[model samples]
Target: MKLSLAEQMREMDKKAIEHGIPDIVLMENASIKSFYQILDAYGDVSGSLAVCFVGAGNNGGDALAIARHLYNNYCDVFIYMLVPEEKLNPSPKTNFEIIKNMGIPYKFVENDDDFDIEVINEADLIIDGIFGTGLSRKVEGRFKKAIELINDSDAFVVSVDIPSGIKADSGEVMGIAVEADLTPTFALAKPGHFLYPGRIYAKDVRVVDISTPVSVIEEFDPSFVAIDSSQIKLTYRNPTSHKGDFGHLAVVGGSTGKSGAVIMASKAALKSGVGLVSAVIPASINTAFESHLLEAMSYPVDDNGGFFSENSIDSILEFVADKSAVCLGMGLGVTESTKKVVKAVMGIEKPMIIDADGLNCLSFFVDELKNRKAPTIITPHPKEFSRLCGVKTKEVLEKRLELIKEFATNYNCIVVLKMADTLIASPDGKIYINTTGNVGLATGGSGDVLSGMIGAFLAEGYEPLQAAINGVYLHGLAADIATESSISYESLMPSDVIENINKAILSFFEA
Candidate 1:
C-alpha cells in the first residue's frame, strides 16, 4: 500500500476538495468511519463513559463529532477542550458549536490541574485529538498532561489521524506522543503510522476511506510503499523444467573464523530455489564448506594464513565467470588483498549483492560502485552505511531514507538499508518500507541469508528491484513464521529462517 507523507496527504485533501468533495463532507465521513471502528472494537459502547481530549484542529473536530455520536448512542461523554472554543479552526469551530447546542458537557482547561483525575481513571474510553499530521513542534502544557493521563489510565484509547506528537513523515516522537490502542487514519496511512516509534505509538492503525477521490490519490502518485504479500509476484515453476532451468548463483566470501557465514549464505541460496549454488572460499576452510554444504559446490582458492589474498583474484574471477549472479562479502575479512579481490569482482558483468565485510571494503573506495556496468545491490546496516556515506551512525539512522535515495541515484545501484524497518531504495528514487520480521532476526548470519536470497532471485532473472523487494519481504516473513511456530525469538537462528523459506513462499500463495 502507498504510504503518504504529511504534505502529500494535505495536497491529496486539497485535490479532493477541488474535485467537488466538500471539506465538511470529508470530516463527516472520517468521523463516521472512525466511530464504526470504535463500535467494531467495543460492540456496545452505548453506556460507556468516554473522555475526549480536544485541540484546535480538524482532528479535534473529528473528536467532537465522534463525541456527539457517542452521546446520541446513550453514552456518557465529556469533552476536555485544551484550547478555547473561539480558537478552533473553521470546521472544528462548527463542530464545537453543534456539540455545545446539544448540551455535551465540556470545560475549557489550561493545564493538567483542571483535569478530573478520578473521572479520567474511571472512564471506559479516551479519544485523543490534541494534534494531527501538521505537528512540527514538541507537545507541551495541557496537551502533554492530557497524553500522560490517557497513557496512565487503563481506558481504551483511540487517536484521530495519527497518534498526536508523532511526525507524520519521519515518525519522530516530539517530546511525548499518545500511545493509542487504535488509530483511524483517513484515506491513506501516513509514514509515521508505520515508521519506528510512531508505529509503536499509533498501534493497530486502520485506514478509513474518507471519500478522497481515487483520481486525486492516483494523481499524487506516492513514491513510498509498504512491502507486503500483495506486492510479491511469485513465478510459477514449470513441472517439466529441470534444475538448470532456474539459474545458478555464486556465493563468494569466507575467511578462517567466519566460514560459517558463507555456508549459511549458500544454504539459503539453495533453499531459495536456485538451480545451482557454488561457494568460493579460502583453501584452508574448504573442508568446512564441503562438510556443511551437501547440495552446493565449493571452489577453494589460494589464501595467506586462511584469509583471502591477492593470489585468489584470478581463480575467484574464473570460478564465478559462468555464474548467473554473485553474492559477495559475508565474513570476508577486510584487508588490502581481499579489497583488491572485491574490486576485481566488481568489474565482472553479473548482478552482484555486496554485504557484511564486502560493504566494509567498499566503504574504503565507494566511488568504485559508479564504475560497475552490471546491476549492483548493497545491503548495509546503519554503521556500514555510515562508513559508505562518510556520516555517523546516528546520522545514518536519522537521514536513512534521504541518504539511501541519494546513494542509489548517484551510484546507479539498488540500496537496501537494513534496520528494524528495512528500507529498499531504487536508482529511480522509489522506496519500499518492509514491516516484517521480529526481534528474532537480530542475530548473526541474518544479513548473509538475505544476500543469498536476493542473489538467487537475481540469478533467476528477476529484475534488481523486484529481487531486492522479494528477498527482503520473504526474509522477514520467514523469521515471523519461525517465531509463530515452535521456535522462540531467543532460539530463532538464521538457519531456522532459511528452513522456513518454503513456508514463507507458501504463505503468499495461501493468502
Candidate 2:
C-alpha cells in the first residue's frame, strides 16, 4: 500500500529534505523528469514551440526549470506565471530570475490583456504548472481563465504531478480542473489521478521515480494499493492439480423475475476454475441452468415461483454438505421466508460469501455473521452497501476507506465495497482498491458474478483477504479482456463478462 497521491508527494519531499537533499535539487530532479516525459511522449522538439503555465508557488519553479530544458532543445518556450511577481515565494522567485537572465520569453498575467491565449493556442504543447498537489481550495479568478484558455487550445497538454484544480487526497475537483492528454506524475500515482473526476481529467498518467526511496514508502504506510496484471498472474493455480482440488461453490439465489442473477454467478464460478458448482435455486431455474449452463449442476429447491422459502433450508443444508464454499444473495428475494432461510444458512459452519440479498439479510443479523466459524465475505455494490451501512451513497463514495473499515469490523466479515473503483476491506483495516474493472462493468448481475468468483477462490484455499483481493482483480481483469468490440459500459452486460472469464483466467497461466 502506498500513501495517497498528495501524502505520497509530501512524504517524499519531507524525507528528501531530511536526508539533506536540497529543495532546489529535488525541484531540478522533478523538472527534468517532467521534461523527459514531454520529450518521450511527443519526441524531439528542436525548433518547436511550448507554453508553460506557472504559479507563484514552487509549482511555478518546476515550469521555469522545464522552460530552461525546452530552450536546450532549441524550442521557442514562453513561461506565463499566472500570479503577480510580488506574490512569488523565494524558490519560485529564484527560478524566475534565472529564466529572465537566460533571455527566455516570460511574463506575469496581470489581466486579460496579458493573457496570451493565441500564443498558447499556436504552440505545440501546453505544460500545466498552475497548481500542484498542495492546492486544497477552489479555483477562481485569473487562474480559472488561464486553465480554460490552455484547455481550449489545440496544443496537447501535459500536467505535472496532478491535473490542476483536482484534490490529490480526495480526488474531488475543487472548481474546474485541467484536462490533460498526458499527465507526468512524480513518485506514485495520486489518488486523484486514479479516482473519478481526476481519473477522467488525467487522460494518460505516468509515475516518475523522483528518488523517493523505498524506505520512505514503508515509513508512511499508504492505505491504497495498485493492482497489476503481474500480481494476478502470480496467484495462478497448479496445472498438475485435479478438478476436485480446485474448489466447490454452492450458488444460492434467483427468483422468477430475478433468475438471471444466480445464473450469472454460477457461470462465473465455473469459468473462474471452480470445478464443482451446484446452483440451488427455485425449481423453475433448474431447467434454465440445464439448457443455459452446460457445466453447472442445478439442484431444484421447492419454491413459490418468485422466491425461496424456509422449506428449502433442509435440502439447501444437504446441498452444502460437501461443498467447499457457499455464495448466497443475488436474486434471492427479500421475503420473510427467504430471510429465515438466509439466517439458517449463515449459521452453518462453512466458507460463505453473502452478496446482494444475502448482504441485506446479514445486515440484520450481525451477531450471526460475527459468531460464525466460517470465513465469510459480503460483497455490496454502492447502493446495496448504502442499505447495509444505513447512510447516503455519497458518504460511502466520498470517504470509502473509512466506511469500508467500519462496516468490515462491525460485521466481522471481509467487505467488498463495489463501485467504479471497488474496495476490498478486511476487519484488520487492510484495504485494496481494485485497479482492474472499467466502466463497462456497471451493469446488472455483475456483483453476483463477483460474489461467485470470491467464493471460488475461498473454496480453493485462499484466505478471506486473498480471496477478495484475487476475486475482485480477476472479475475486473476479465471485463477488460472482453472489451474487444469496444463496448461501452452502458452496453456491456453480465453475460458479456461471463464469456471472457476463461480468457482472463488463462492469461494468468500463459507463457
Please report the candidate that would top TM-score against the real structure: 1
> What is the C-alpha lDDT profile of model 1 across 95-172, one tens digit per residue?
899998999999999867999999999999899989999999989988899989999999999999999889998889
For residue 470, model 1's alpha carbon misses the true position, in angstroms, by 0.7
**Prediction-by-prediction clash tally:** 0, 4
After superposing candidate 2 on the true structure, give the runs of residues whose Cα lies further than 4 Å from its correct spot.
1-5, 218-220, 233-239, 486-490
* lDDT of the structure predicted as candidate 1: 0.91
Q: Best by lDDT, which number?
A: 1
TM-score of 1: 0.98
Q: lDDT (CA) for every model shown?
A: 0.91, 0.81
Candidate 2 per-residue lDDT over residues 103-143, each given as its tens digit: 99887787767886678789898889999888999999888
**Candidate 1 ranges with C-alpha deviation above 4 Å:** none
- The weakest ten consecutive residues by lDDT in model 1 span 214-223
